[model samples]
Target: MAYKMPTQKYSGKILEVTVGSDLKLGGESVLPFYGFDGNIGNKPAIGMEIWDIFPESWPAAVLDVFKDAADDPLKWAAYCVEKYKPDFICIKFEGASPDGLNRSVEECAEIAKKLADNLTVPLVIAGCQDNDKNAKLFTKIAEALTNKNYAFLSAIEANYKEVAAAVGLAYGNIVVAESSVDLNLAKQLNILITQLGVKPDKMLMNPGCAAVGYGFEYVITTLDRIKLAALEQNDETLQMPIISPVSFEAWKVKESVVTQEDIPEWGPQEERGVAMEISSAVGVLAAGANAVILRHPRSVEVIRNFITEMTE
Candidate 1:
């Protein structure tokens, strides 16, 4: 006799946020990959992240994969989309940082326009993690690419209200609200952003992520709590779809960046980095990230396979 598994019905579905024209994220009425228990609104999406400035410090493994393309954002992005076929391209304007290139908002906006015009997939514009600078950067970029919809990498509570009004209200571009890995902060940001008229359907949430072994359990626990709040408890604010940027955190860790000479038994540095990225990415996806941005092609390949096996 076949054992029948009972389904735990959920109250609300995660809002579906569209990217790159027809591609949609979220929409599940139950926990991620528990389709037997409920509906799977959409299969998870993956992205490859690149920087506007040459990532001179990139690990040899990743640099080898990108090679010449790493020298230019447009070339880097083209290479990623053509070779790896990520669901989207996350263009981090690291050069715009006041400490880095200190590029003016006007200059960064122009570069963003170029990427938006050239890329086949949707663009997720990322700032250099400076709240004040991002407020200006996001606004200028949003103004530049009006009507040509794209997603922002994030709008933290510190600046999301203003960003939500500018990109979301002014240009109708998708907004992403980010909060540290805390359910209360996540819900609070959602509430604040929505108050400014950004619909959940037009917004995504980023529960700030950590490297696989570095405070990563907090991320998983936070994601799990968000799922519990939204699905069973019917928490509206926390129901926004989650997008986790894995590559930045995964690649910067000591395990990924340390050299073979520095640590003899750590195996090949490239393979180790890719393994870290894959572990962190898959961990986030399983923990309820609707989208994850990875760096290495190999990590994307492995995670894509994992997503297909689980979703299909």
Candidate 2:
């Protein structure tokens, strides 16, 4: 007799959110990659992270991959789209942060509008890490490019009211409800965002993730808990798709940054950075990320292939 894999049925489905014209995420009625057990509507979408103003902190090895267009955001984004062909483009408005260059809302919005207007793929607009800055910037950008079906990287508990109201509800775009890696906090944040009229289908959850070996277990456990609740308990509030900004968290770790001279045992710098990104991205995809945003074209290519081999 042949051995058989056990199958399980889930009661609830993860609501699907569309980006650009056709990229779909979530709608899986089972845990990540359990296709034999239940319906998995779409393969996780992979987005490339482009910056409004490029950061100088990137590794030289990885930088070499994008050297031709690294200095200019528009060129960089177009280059990535033309070359890598990512599912979507995630624009990091780092210059607009209050602590950073403190770029004006209009300046950032103009750049954002230009990118949105030119990019053919769906755009994910991530504001600087400041709540106030993100609120103003998101609102400005949303107003400038309405109905293009863009997504925001986050609306935290602190500014859910402003973001959910202004961008999610008013502009009719998707909002990511971000919370620390805790089940209840994630659920509560989702509930709050939904209460503001941003329906589940128009929302994605960011239950927080970290690079591999850098508090990554918390990411997995949190994702598992959320998926269980959404599938087994049929928790509507927790049923939105999950989008992990893997690049933002992964590239900053020491493993990706230290030079081989600085740490000979760590091996090559660019290869290490790409490894870190791929590990973080694939780890989250297996754990539960419905979509992941990545840096480093090599990392994106590897994970894109992995997703195809598994999900397709």
Best by lDDT: 1
lDDT values of the candidates? Answer: 0.89, 0.88
Tens digits of lDDT, candidate 2, 134-184: 998988888887777789878998899998887788887788899999999
> Across residues 140-242, which tens digit of lDDT does each residue of candidate 1 receive?
9999989566889789978887799998999889899888899999998889888999888888889889888999999999999998899888888888889
Q: What local lDDT does model 1 show for residue 54?
A: 89
> What lDDT is obtained when candidate 2 is compared to the true structure?
0.88
> Candidate 1, 207: how far from true, in Å?
1.2
TM-score of 1: 0.97
- Give each model a TM-score: 0.97, 0.97
Score residue 257 of candidate 1 by CA lDDT: 92
